[model samples]
Target chain A: MAPILEARHLSKRFRIPSVKRSTVREHVLGMLRPSSTEELVVLDDVSFSVERGETLGIMGRNGCGKSTLLKILSGIYMPDTGEVIARGPITPILELGVGWNPELDAIDNILLLGSVMGMSLKELRQATDEILAFAELERFANMKLQHYSSGMASRLAYAVAFRAVREILILDEIFAVGDAGFRERCESRFRELHSSGHTAIVVSHDPRTIKTFCDRALLVDRGHVVVQGDGLTVADAYTALLTHEPAAAAPTAALPEAVPAS
Target chain B: MADAPTRRHHWGGLVWTLVRTDFKARYHGTVGGFVWALLKPFTMFLVLLGVFSFIFASDPVYKRNLLLGLFLWDFFAEGTKVGIISMHQKGYLLTKTRFPSWIVVVTSASNAVITLAVFTVAIVGFLALTGRTPSPVELVLYLAYLVAALLIVAGISLAGSVLFLRYRDLNQVWDVVTQAGFFVAPIIYPLNILPERFHFYLYLWPPTAIIQFSRAVLVQHDIPTLRAHLMLLGMTAVVFTAGAAIYRRFAPRAVEYI
Candidate 1:
């Protein structure tokens, strides 16, 4: 099957400014030129592809470029060297409720949020009752979102995201939101959605989520993908990188052949 | 929300949504709130008319045209003032989402328009009460001038929003400009009273044409010539396009700066 999403030689860089609050005026005036701060490559030359109807997971330590990679894939940030070519609708939950207007009611936010995620207000109205009910916010739909608790925002955001007719979903650490019960509901929903042939790119350090749910996994470190293969091998290598430092990572053993051969 | 409706539809929907929210939140929680839009401009008109009418009664030009000119100037002043603060006030919306960002300026201008709408009704009523009923030609001229005033204020608002975004210091500069525009735009005094050399500046001012056209229609009951109409339209077009280009180039960066 043709890939639903592809990233070729993707890279991103950030320039840190040399100036600091402690820099004295005399020192600043002493030099005709401002110093160049170090350039940090947040996402190095990394490439990956997501085939249609596939579940892929990325496991890494903090600042492993997982979010950056997802951003490039979602077109939020253009890659420095390459492109993220996708074939279908992509919904990225990089930060849930990123566009919520506090003064507006949740219903209004639902309309705006749905639009940002590529749904029209007409389509949003169709899913309105389901979204509110899933978030357990039927009564509070008319209230301003500023009044919502953290968990409430998480629930509503998750409900709205999963409710869309998204061909590809990129989740960035948003699954950890809400309580254990909500997490279980989300996991079951993932199972149901996956069975319907939906594609998902989930970024998590959780071994259980990777080994159990992901058909394939990639281990990323310092903006580079070190290993890409079966769930068990990638997850074990990721765990090793965490427990031991990145320098101590042993060569990953072959994963079981029972998994889909990516 | 409907996936980029027709150009006319898309722009119109965006303007309406923003304008509605702008109108709502601005006066939210106050008693008899929206009425304040009408009351405020009306009060300014009465006060200024009283003060200026007494001071400049001997001058026929001032007595004839000052009210309409002052009314239009008030709209531009209030519109541009709010336009400067619009993106900052709605920082949450701008920082995260990208939709017709120009609507911020449009919404502020619309607020001014809404307030000015009431002033318009009062203008008609004032004329009737004073037995200065306008001819059909003059009535049509009022429409032309209304369109001109709206266009000028809206265009300046678009440019002002962009400048405020690029250079934050311009917020103070605009406050001074509105004050300056009020005195310099010939609101209190007619251009005839100013020396001929200075009168040239008035013709060059885009808003001055709007003010002059409005005064001619509302006070003198005369329609603008085809040349004057075309000039106002051309100026409106240039400012609107320039403002849009400036906004399109920098509005995305507004996310980082804002």
Candidate 2:
């Protein structure tokens, strides 16, 4: 089968005005002066694809455009130059608890965030008990989110998001939080998803996660893909790059291009 | 392209959830809960009625007309007022997820819609208490004009929501506009109090036309001319189309500015 998702030469550039003009008076006065804008290229001709039932890991330094690339793939940001072709619906957990209202209780938040993640109300209502159990917040289900600890909130966010996953899941730094037991549960759930043939694209800084969970991985530096190989090899390359230079420098010499999945 | 299915699947549920959450949050802690929605317009109506009663008391239908006009204006004013700030208030959701941006504006205006519905029922009740029941034809005509008013609100909101993201002071500007509009739209006084030439200019504003047309049909028992009906429809179409176009063009880049 053809790749489930593909990014063809995707590029994104954001224009930063020299001075912020957020009011009508400033905007009108701005017309009298010469306009100055600086364009920042967040993504530069990046290309990749994910096959059915495959887990792809994107490892990049801070501000290397991993999030931007994921935003484009998830349809949150429009690319300036290229296009993303997605054969399946994409559920992006770009951040946990994105729409969570602290004023609402756990059940209310599950309904709100679940719908935001593309789950129907019926499905959310049916799984509310299961979600609370998963998050280990059954006792605090009716308590307002404001009263819950940050960890509890993260767990609820993850539980609802996990249940709302569709044909393709795009997660950004999902494992950066949560306790040891919750992390273990998430790993087992991810394993179950992988075995069940759910395609996913995960972005993380941890090489162990990429090596242990990803089928293939790409190392990105300064908006360009530096290398693509098996999980372990690419993970090792990332670790070496990090050790050599804490801050990402110029892109290294060309390495192997992405190998098409058989 | 690939996200279309997910968006389409979640559109209705998402809109409903947002609107419901908004209502709950606004009223959840209050003792009266949903009663607050009705109480706002009614209190405003009572206050305005007392303040202007002596000036317009000569007119037999002044009370009913004032209540009706207040409800219509409240919908337009409150809807656009909240709708304009909705994009900025919901900016977090926009940046973090992928859904049609217009849903935010629609959800914001929904509170006004509900308030208007409840206020309309109150108006009918007040009419009955005063021993002047509106005819079915008049009621239907009034509803049509209310819908036209809603269209105008939706149009303003669509453009305002996005524009407000760029211009932070838009909400304050809208507040001043709405405050000025209450007097300009013939809500408290009869249209006949103004000169005939000024009447035409007033009718040019969509809200004036809506309020006048509704008063004519429902309270004054006077049917408006077909030309008046066509004018309201034309104005509604223009405002709604332009708003939708502006929203479509600017909403995509709204997140960048926000």
Candidate 3:
């Protein structure tokens, strides 16, 4: 079967104005002088594909455009010169409880965020109890989220998002939060989804996670794909790249092209 | 493709949730709660009625007309004002997910619609107390005008919200426009009070046509001409289309600025 998701020659560039003018008065004064902009290429001709049910891990250092790549794939940000073809709905857990209203209780927030994630009202309503149970916040389900601890809120967000996951899930730092026990539950749940043939593209800095959880992985450095291979190989490359001097030449030509899934 | 219905269902559910949550969050922890929604236009109506009654003492239906005018004007003013800032208020949602951007503006403006619905009940009570209930035909005509007013607000808001991301001072500019609009739209006094020649100019503003025609049908028991109806429809179409066009041009880049 063809890949469930394909990104072809994706490139994104952002222009940063030398002087930010966000007011009408400042804009009026800005016309007197020609403003200059510095262009930043966040992603450069990056190409990749994910087969159905496969987990693709993206390993990168800070500011290497990992999050930007995920955002583009999830349709949160449009690529400047390329396209993303998704065969099915994409549930992007870029941030948990994105539309959550702190004034609302857990049930209301589940309804809000779940719908925002493309779940129907009936599905969300039926799954509300299950979500609350998963988060272990059944007792606090009626309480306002603002009054809850940050960890509790994070749990609720994860519970709600997991319930609302659709065809393809794009997760950013899914294991970055929660206690060890809660992280264990998340990992098991993720494994269950993976076994059930839910395609996912997970971005993380931890090589161990990529090695253990991902079937295939890509190492990215400064807007270029450094290498793509089986999980362990790419993870080792990421670790080795970290120790090398920043000024050392990147092994861009030596790496093989990202093989599109057949 | 088979899940198309599910996608529609989700968007509908999302819009409803956002609107409902907005209504609750605005009134949460308040002493008056939802009552404040009613009190705002009613209080303004009372103040305006008191002052305007002295000026138009000769007209018998002045009270009803003034109340209706205020309610309609309040909806427009409140809707656009809230709608303009809605994108920024919901910036977190836009940046974190992929959904229709227009939902943010519509949900923010919908609070005004709910307030107007509640105000409609109050209007009926006031009309009954004054022994001047509108005919069914008049109510229908008035409803059509209310829809037109809403479209005008939606149009302005659609453009305003996107523009607001770049021009942070847009709300202040809108405040000035609405402040001037309050008097220019014939909210406190009837349009006839102005010269007949200037009436055409006043009608050029969409709200002016909406408020005046609404008052003409519901309070004055007068049916507007077919030409006037067409004019209102044309103006609404133009405003809404222009706003949608501007939004389409700019909204794609809105997330960057936000």
Q: Tell me, by DockQ, which candidate is best.
A: 2
Clash pairs detected, candidate 1: none
Pairs with steric clashes in candidate 3: none
Could you give the fnat of all candidates in order?
0.07, 0.47, 0.50
Total backbone clashes of candidate 3, pairs 3 or more residues apart or in separate chains = 0
lDDT per residue (tens digit) for residues A1-262 in model 1: 6688888888777555465322234344647766645466767678888888898999887876787788667665556677767777776675665556677778877765665555656667899999998778899999988898877876888888889646777887646878787788888888888999999999887888888888998988777888899898888888778778675364442322232211
Candidate 1 falls in which docking quality class? incorrect
Instruction: Kindly list the per-residue Cα lDDT of model 1 for residues B183-248, writing each as its tens digit.
Output: 778877767777888876777777688888878877876777898788878887887677777777
Candidate 2 regions with alpha-carbon error over 4 angstroms: A245-262, B1-3, B6-10, B29-31
Q: Where does candidate 1 chain A have its weakest 10-residue lDDT segment?
A: A253-262
lDDT of 2 by residue, A79-154 (tens): 7778888888787877665556788888888887788777888888899999998888999998998888878887
Candidate 3 lDDT tens digits, B1-258: 111213444688989888888887888735479788778878998998878899999998888788888888889999999999989988877876677899888789878998898878777667768788888888888889888988999999999999999999999999999999998998888788788999988888778998889888877789999998999999999999999999999887688788
Q: Score chain B of each candidate by TM-score.
A: 0.84, 0.92, 0.93
Task: Please rank every candidate by lDDT, starting with the best.
Answer: 3, 2, 1
